[model samples]
Target: MRLVFGLVLIIGVGLAGFAVFMAKDYIGAYQAQLDAERAARANAVPTVEVFVVNRGLRYGEQLTEADIRPVRWPENAIPDGTFRALAEIFPDGEKKFRTVLRAMEKDEALMQVKVTKPGADAGVSSRLSAGMRAFAIKVDVSSGVSGFLRPGDRVDVYWTGRGASELGGGTSGVTKLILPGVQLIAVDQIADSDQSAPTIARTVTVEVTPRQVAALAQAQATGNLSLSLVGAKDDTVSDAVEVDQSEFTGETVAKEKEVCTVRTRRGAEIIETQIACPE
Candidate 1:
């Protein structure tokens, strides 16, 4: 009887120890799962639905229902001038009536600068700022920066023409910088600044002030206008640039020869004198 009681007591203690170990493992697994879930929630980024282009759009292309759709964009990554609701952009059932000002790739967000006002198309007149005028100039393969010029590029305008000689002789050829940091608004009839490749446009339009318009008009009429491409971020004003034929050919301009002469006076009789002139 004593051996039986001892065996029963040992069996009960072993079962209790096993139950404790199993309970500890179960609790540890539950805690690990909860920690994992909390971490995932904390690392998640918030997103919102905003309209994006479903198809690539070019300038003057009309925006329709099929062209745009809503997609999830991170709230923190949302760009400015984006529309969150369709009604705000189209104003109730007018999706196919608006035009785009600039080109947009697929999935690109619609911004204020990329689109035109309601019921308006992309044109040169629409892009002009207040008190600004659009001036057009003739361009060619050589004068137009080898057809690499595009809208939104900056250019320096150089005028080449004949100017009256200071020596009162015939006109002399002259070339000088007339305008700098001028913003190009269009290449030919295309006002969009989103050109993918260089093209040779016959005409280029630039945005200018009224005073600049006058200057550019006279310069274009009197001389051949040439465009010089400026740096993308360049704001440095260049020094006065003027070049003449002598300067271009790097020839030493000659100075007039100095001469010496004397005047002869006669009493009641005029005397003729042939002598060297004074300097």
Candidate 2:
């Protein structure tokens, strides 16, 4: 009887120990959750309702009530030019004439530069800034950087035409640089800011000054134009870059001469003669 009693006492003690261990574990988990909640409350910041995009938006797209949504943004973290009130984004709950000037992602804040004014169209003329002109150039697979060119990239213009050297003798076909560091405004008809993929476009428009427009127009009319993409960090100045067949093929270039000389013999005496050479 004593042996059986001893066995029962040991089993009870073991079960009691396991129950205490389980209770301690449960208490620890509950305390951890409570501490987390307290921290969240202490670090909370003030927030305000602001207008944001409900879905991805493209350039030249008209704005509507369904395209925007209100979200709680931190008061101190609000971006510049963002609209805080719904009326500011769309007066009287209407956006009938506004359009997107640039593409925006979902939940992005609405900014002044990202949209056009009331009754403004998103055409090419609207995209140009003050004092900037748009010039379109014909492009092919070889001249346009093989469909890798896109809007927002800077490029250098090259003219592949025949022209004479400064000495003015015979004309040699040469390729020369016309413009450098020009910003591309659009590819074909797409001016969206979100386009990052390679596209094959027949025509590309660039932003230039009034003088640049004249120079580009003359170069295009006289010769074939080609575009070269410029790197974001490249600072090398491109000017007077020219190459001819002789230079490219490493052949000897003939110098332009105004006069030619010939050796003649008269009565066993050597005589030198000068003659005019045709250009």
Candidate 3:
């Protein structure tokens, strides 16, 4: 009986030791995995919730709470003017909704410049900057860039007309660049910039300052106005461009010879004598 008891005790002790060894290995592995997970979380990029359009939206459409949703965006890479919360987009708890100024696609961030203020309509006025005015200019196939202009394009205005003889330009009309890089706010009556198809617009509106409006008005009244499309990425300032019939025909203008005269009184008659012009 004593021998059997000793063998049973030894086997029980061995089983407990083996179980403890396996448990220690498992705990060490679990602790290592937990530390790795914590390190990964510390290195992860920070993000913030920003509002984005739930679906594609068009210009002039009203934006409501249902049309937008929140998405996690990298905190450092968030775009300027992006709405960060519902209160920022809809302030004062007012029921007024904003109107889209530019078309937006699904998941696009909402920006202040892309939408009008609450209860405001998206119109040409909204696109104009402070102290800017909207002026309408008539256009045709030849002057409107073959109907390829859109609402958001910039153009150079050219005035072609006869100048007074005192100004050195004669009956042959002169084409001069009146305006450089003026922004187009509306093509015909449409203010939306999403227009892709080319349509021959009879009249196009441009955003300009009060001084520019006066100059354009006078130029349009006295001469014919033509528009030249400017490249979207072109930022070089255009020099003063003036083309006349003489330059177009490759003819050089001739300068008249200077003449000088002297007057001498002889009795009752006044005589004029020719002399060399002063140096």
Candidate 4:
């Protein structure tokens, strides 16, 4: 019986020791997880705060840090709140966080592109830049003229001038297209002009180079000019006359077309007048 009791005691002690060992291991593992979490927290870089607000801004606008702020930040992540302040020290720039107002408008070419003194040496003028010598010719496109015509639309320009085909005639002179294709920079009324009602004049202004400006001015003064809505990115050049109309079509047609009228007097002295269309 004594030997059995001693064996039982040894088993009980062994079981207790095993349980203590397991508890120790469990505690160590839990502490290790805590240490790892603490180290991660220590190594974590504080997040910067940037806020976005809705403002109507033009394209290519230089953004400053003051333009944004973080409305919310993670707890204990930012040490001195320097991230929000750092944006101010930065110069005007473009960043992923910076938003544009007219991003969806998409008609950027209609927006006037001006070259300031600072922008002059930026190589923009050396290429496809619209400068002071350029001219913005306003063309009235009434009826279905303005339909499907968005800003930055490209078009082909045609003019009446002496050409080979005309020269072949007995008169030894021919009327032909002078300029075929021109880029439409803006499809809008001149600035500060009313464009709300159909009766109101809505002019489509196009930008042309100095030489082309002179040609366009002469064309506007002497010949009738019209616009074909070429809803395309690239300027298409062709001699084909898609729309054949009188050269000098303005934006709006007249309100009352006819001026003459026929009148008859009845026996009761009732006067009746019927307006007639122009012949």
The list of candidate 4 runs beyond 4 A from truth reads 1-133, 142-148, 161-167, 170-202, 233-279
* Residue clash pairs of candidate 1: 259-277, 260-276, 260-277, 261-278
List lDDT for all candidates, in order.
Answer: 0.86, 0.85, 0.91, 0.45
Model 2 residue runs over 4 Å out of place are 1-50, 69-81, 84-96, 166-168, 232-240, 256-279
Pick the lDDT winner.
3
Cα lDDT tens digits, model 1, 1-279, are: 999999999999999999999999999999999999999999999999999998888888998667889999999999999989887677864534568888899999988778876667788877887899999999999889999888889999999999865544566788999998899999998787888688998999999999999999999999899999999988898778988776657655455666555556788776666577654
Give the alpha carbon lDDT tens digit for every residue of 23-115 in model 2: 999999999999999999899998998889888888878877688878899999998888887677667645455788788899899887788
TM-score to true structure, per model: 0.71, 0.64, 0.89, 0.40
Tens-digit lDDT track of model 3 for 57-110: 999999998999999999999999999889988888566589998999999999
Alpha-carbon deviation at 184 in model 4, angstroms:
3.7
Q: Which ten residues in a row have the lowest lDDT in candidate 3?
A: 164-173
Backbone N/Cα/C clashes per model = 4, 0, 0, 8
Cα lDDT over the full model 4: 0.45
Give the CA lDDT, 0 to 100, for residue 78 in model 1: 96
Rank list by TM-score:
3, 1, 2, 4
